[model samples]
Target chain A: MPDSAFAEIRNLDLFAQMTDENFAALMRGAYVQNFPAQIDLISEGDPSDFLHVVLSGSVDLFSTWNGRDTSLATVRPIATFILAATVKDAPYLMSARTLEKSRIALIPSQDVRAIFDVDGNFARAVVTELAQSYRTVVKSQKDLKLRTSLERLANYVLRQQKRSGEVSSFFLECEKRRLASVLGMTPENLSRAFKGLVPYGVQVEGTRVTILDQGELERFAKPNPLIDDTSV
Target chain B: MPDSAFAEIRNLDLFAQMTDENFAALMRGAYVQNFPAQIDLISEGDPSDFLHVVLSGSVDLFSTWNGRDTSLATVRPIATFILAATVKDAPYLMSARTLEKSRIALIPSQDVRAIFDVDGNFARAVVTELAQSYRTVVKSQKDLKLRTSLERLANYVLRQQKRSGEVSSFFLECEKRRLASVLGMTPENLSRAFKGLVPYGVQVEGTRVTILDQGELERFAKPNPLIDDTSV
Candidate 1:
């Protein structure tokens, strides 16, 4: 692996507290690889063997059932995916695929488990990361259960705008079909949902969304911090 | 707390690996309380100060928005709720209430965090518990996203049947209204859903359910371990 890659891994919250020796030991058995867009990185029900860290580009975590699939989450640059699965030595509950040409570091899960047993700081970091991940998912569930699909779409647009540096308008980072899956709606429903938000001052032209009336949308979406806030 | 309470807490997977001294210290600030049926225990948006462990009976975790409410999960005996919130010192995302007369232990979140930082075994145990909790919620989301309400109801009956010691007939432990909320449906929709399942050999009378044809039900439910398994 390159020195830059090591620095990237070292900088994540999951590794910031680890001793240099332990971090080096973990990296000793790790490697970095690049994959083309749309390639399957991992599949659900497969035994988790490596802790994957996305160094660049993006990966979509999704679940499949009865020949249908839904997007669970998207992992962007400089974050780890499937840490919980790796920590528990459990099967991947969600399958992952690269959304674009992406670079990722794969650390042996066995090394992670072994080092976690002896490194107190590493263990604490793992607990904190896992706990944060768990809480984020809980929040997502609350949002799904409590909000209507139209409200969900409105808030999602707001969130995406904020994520894209608080711009007044921004292009959606994913396709509308995938966005519909992520929001737990049919593509037809998503189209109708966007139209429903027109009265709330949301303008959708292709993938570009402009929040014309932020206040109106917020009032309608009622985005609760407990459910919408992503920061730990 | 009584001796039996201590034994129950110690036996939980989260505390099973902690040193006895640390366990005793945790108990120093912990207390057990009893609540009557249908009592609200904790509300969403409240600061998480205690890690609640249900000693006996059951607790229903649910959420509300815009005058509508839905069940999130049911916490039975010998399990913890809000561990992620307690660990992260964040506000509870879901409100918890007792479904019946129940005994519960409340441990100060500070003590849990303190021991977690110093005790490696305890830290590992927290990671395992948190990871397992994360996976369970992820599975629930997959179920929500990938399956229609009818399919979810079908699979839920199968799961409940398995949980009730694989009995062919078992009483629905919760009220029909609460079960409807948990299944993310209205009481009317749930009524229709139960009727929809009759073709698969499911019979419902009041709170009683009998799976007359497990084979037919399984074929329709398509229960996948990745989405349904509770065990870590």
Candidate 2:
């Protein structure tokens, strides 16, 4: 096993409560792979085999409809994606691809299900992780339904910036066009929406965005717990 | 304990795995009560003390904003509601009330959590239930976002009819106004949409809607698995 891969297991929430013996058994069958930027990690409608955990760099998780694709979310280092799919043994709702050179911990879904059956703590952990993911998706729905296109964009900017602390500007983790689709707008409309936010103190330069007026932007965005917080 | 109360235990997914001894110990503190229609069993923003299971009739789950209420979902017999809040020990997201004379099982959250710490199989069962509930909510979000208002209502009717079987007609379960709110539309708009579907062979008579054209409605709704499947 790679040294970095062991470190990655220490960081996954699903394995957090696991005993070392249990976790080691988990890593016994697990393997880590490094993918170059733009490599397709998993595709939508494909059978899910492994739960991918991002250890470094970023991966864009997205879905396509009627020949158009939209970003579902971006996975950052130390974050695990696809627990729900793995637990339920369901097909991937969105495809994942590396947005940058990335290292991911690929744990087989069968092992996950097996350990979950035999290990009590691991099962509880799985439950919590799946529940949180489920809530995040629900909030995303409320967002798309309750808010307009411009409102979603404004709030999306606020959420991205808030994650980085006091940073006034940060680069978007996913493609600008994909982010537009996730926000439920056409790329053209998304471009226009970005221009409209200029008055609300949002400045977009390529993939990098600067929030000039956090207060004003938040006021306009009104990020509700049901819409923004995935921790519910 | 009432004979009927034990029957409710069979309905809960969490209690499905408990041994007779474990199940009895867990339910030592449980109680069953019946409420008349329109009784508010739990209110939003209130403490979640017990996991409520519906045994008979229906319960409407909804939220109120600025004195305006929106129906979120309806709970029927043999299913659990508010496990998310109960597990987190958080405030209720939406208020739950009886839609008809209803029987409910209330298991103290403390007992559930206590038994959870000791029973491995029970813990796994709870986790599975929570995870499943969470995914159901996510699917609800996908439905609201991916489908139009007309499509949402149309699919919702089909879902309701499917759940109730090939019955020619069924009750709405909630007020038309609440149903409208749940569908994310004004009562006027829902009424108008109902009228618009006349050519599609829909018949709405107050709270009783009969579908004469299931084929046409499904064609228009185009229910996706991500949106339509409750277990997703």
Candidate 3:
């Protein structure tokens, strides 16, 4: 890896605590690559050979069954995906694809496990990262089980709005179809969900969303931190 | 904790590899108790002060939103739940309750973190456990998003049957109402879902489930290991 890329990764929480020698050992067999948009990086059920770190652009983590595909999550810059699979030496549960031209660092899973066995700092960081990942998924499962599609979309808008500097208006993060899958709704239902939120002062045109009334939408969505807040 | 209880917990993978002294330190502030059925053990959004281990019986991990309640998972004997919350020192994301008369061990979260900072084996075990958990949740989310209620029920029955030592007949593990919530469907819908599987030879008599035709059900359920096999 180049110095600049190495420095960027070193700054990430997962790597920040690791010793320089161990970090170098982990990066020894790793390589950085750039892929065009819509490229498949890894497939579900494949051996988790590499731990992927997205340095730029975005990746969509998705799964398919019975002729249906759903987006499980989207990985953005300065984040790692498939670490759980890598650590467990298990098959990847979700396939990842590039959402746009992107740069990613691939570390061999063996190295991660090898270092984890010997490095306390890396092991602690891994535990923290996995714990965070586990909580995020639990929160997501709660969202899927306890809310209606409209309620999900409303909360999603609020979350995205918060991500975008708490702005009143901002562009949606991904395509509507992918968003629909992530929210566990059909595209038609997503459209109707947006329409359903109109009463709460949410307006959508193309990918742009304007929350005219945050309080009104909050009342309708009833966003709970335990369910919607990933940061916590 | 009693010596017998310590031995049982020591045999668990999470604690088996730690030094005896470190294990003793963890157990110093820990205590075990028995709770009656339907007793709430932990509430969502409260500080995750204890790492709970179910010594016997079962506990339900669930969430609620806007008056709607859903079952997230059931933790049966000889395993831990809410470790993510405990390690993160974050609020409990799911409320836990005993589904039956249960014995539980509560270890102080601080002790878990303190020992985790020192024990490589325990930290690695935590990684392994959390990775397994992360994959299980991903599989479940895929089950919810990619399959209909009927498909989920079919796959669920197949899974339960496997759990029953590949028997053709066994009782459902939990109440139908809880099963419905766990499958993300209404109780009425769950009833209809069971009926929908009749053509494939699934018979439900109260909680008694008899699979008259395993091949037919697996054909319908597709039973992808990626989604259904928690062991993997």
Candidate 4:
């Protein structure tokens, strides 16, 4: 592992509360690897033997059902995926794949469980992380259940814009197909959803989106913090 | 609090791992209350001041947007609700209401947080609980996104049947309207969806459901463990 990688892992909110001794012990069993885009990192039903942390680039978490797949979420750098599976010693519920050339640290799940048992700080940090993750998934479910496809798209664009520094316009970081899956809609429906948003003061040109009227869009989307807030 | 209520609270999985002194301390700050059916216990966006544990009967966790409400899940006896919000000290995302005459124990969120910080076993238990909750929500989201309304209803019936001891027929636990909301459909759509399921050998008589052909329904629903399994 690079020195910078260790520093980066040490600084993550998940690890910040961990004691130095426990963090060092965890690092001892950890290894870093780089993978090309589209490489499968983990598959659903596989035993979660490692707690995979993305150090650079990103990974897409998706699930398959009856030969059909849907995008769940994307894990960016300085974050961990599948921690719940690792912590519970259960099979992975979702498969992960590199979205680009990415670097990830694989920490042995056994080490994680062991340290979690004996390290108070580490255990507390894990609790906080798991709690936040649980709330996030709950919010996502509410968003999906309460909003229509067009409304979901409108709010998603607004969220993306906010994430990109609250500009009136922003570029989509992922493909339209992936966005459609994430929003729980067909690609064709997503295209129509974009057109549907046009009257609500949204304009899409290729990967870029401009919010022509924030007030009208907000009125149409009715974004609720309980459903839309990503922060813990 | 009644002696039975205290005994029930002590036996909960969330309290099982807590140290006796910590558990006692928690109980010292806790109180039990009885509520009539349809009484709202907590509202969305309200501060999570207490960790509510159902001792008897049940509570329906639900959300609302734009004058529409949807059921999220039903919390039965020996289970805690909104732990993620309590642990994170965040607002409750879903409002909870008593489904029947219910008894609930409310432990101050501050005491829970304080004890969690000092009790390693309790911390580990919280992690396990939170992780399980996170996966359950993820599975629900996947089920909603991947399956058609009819398919969702089909699988939901199968899961409920299994929960009712794999019987060929069982009574629907909640009202049809509440079940419809939980399944992310209107009562009218649910009625239509039940008709759609008849070709696969499902028959509903008022509150009772009979699965005459499990094979046909399973084939149609195509239940996957990643989406259907509830056990942690």
TM-score for predicted model 1 compared with the true structure: 0.98
The DockQ-based order of candidates, best leading, equals 3, 4, 1, 2
- List the candidate 3 regions with Cα displacement exceeding 4 Å: none
All DockQ scores: 0.81, 0.39, 0.89, 0.84
Which residue pairs in candidate 1 have backbone atoms (N, alpha carbon, C) closer than 3 angstroms, thus clashing?
Answer: none
Docking class of 1: high
Model 3 has how many clashing residue pairs? 0
Looking at model 3, give its docking quality level.
high
lDDT per residue for candidate 2 within A135-195, as digits (tens), equals 5665565566456789889888988887777599999876777788778777899999999
**On TM-score, who's better, 1 or 2?**
1
- How much lDDT does each candidate structure score? 0.92, 0.78, 0.92, 0.91
Candidate 2 residue-wise lDDT, B34-117, digit = tens: 899999998876878998988899999876533346677788878888876766666666688998999999989877777777
**C-alpha lDDT of residue A43 in model 4:** 96
Best by TM-score: 3
Tell me, by DockQ, which candidate is best.
3
Candidate 2 wrong stretches, greater than 4 Å:
A64-70, A167-171, A195-215, A225-227, A230-232, B43-47, B64-69, B167-171, B207-214
Residue ranges of candidate 4 with Cα displaced over 4 Å: none
Residue A56, model 3: Cα distance from true site in angstroms:
0.4
Minimal lDDT window, size 10, model 4 chain B = B1-10
lDDT of 4 by residue, B1-232 (tens): 6788888888877788788899999899899998999999999999999999988899999999988889999999889999999989999999999999999999999999999889988888889888988999989988998888999999999999989999999999999999999999999999999999999999999999999999999999988888897984
Indicate whether candidate 1 or candidate 3 has the larger TM-score: 3
What is the lDDT for B110 in model 2? 78
Q: Estimate, for each residue in A1-232, the C-alpha lDDT of model 3 and write its tens digit.
A: 8999999999999999989999999999999999999999999999999999999999999998878999999999899999999888889999999999999999999999898889988988998999898888988999998988888899999999988999999999798988999999889989888998999999999999999998899999898889877789
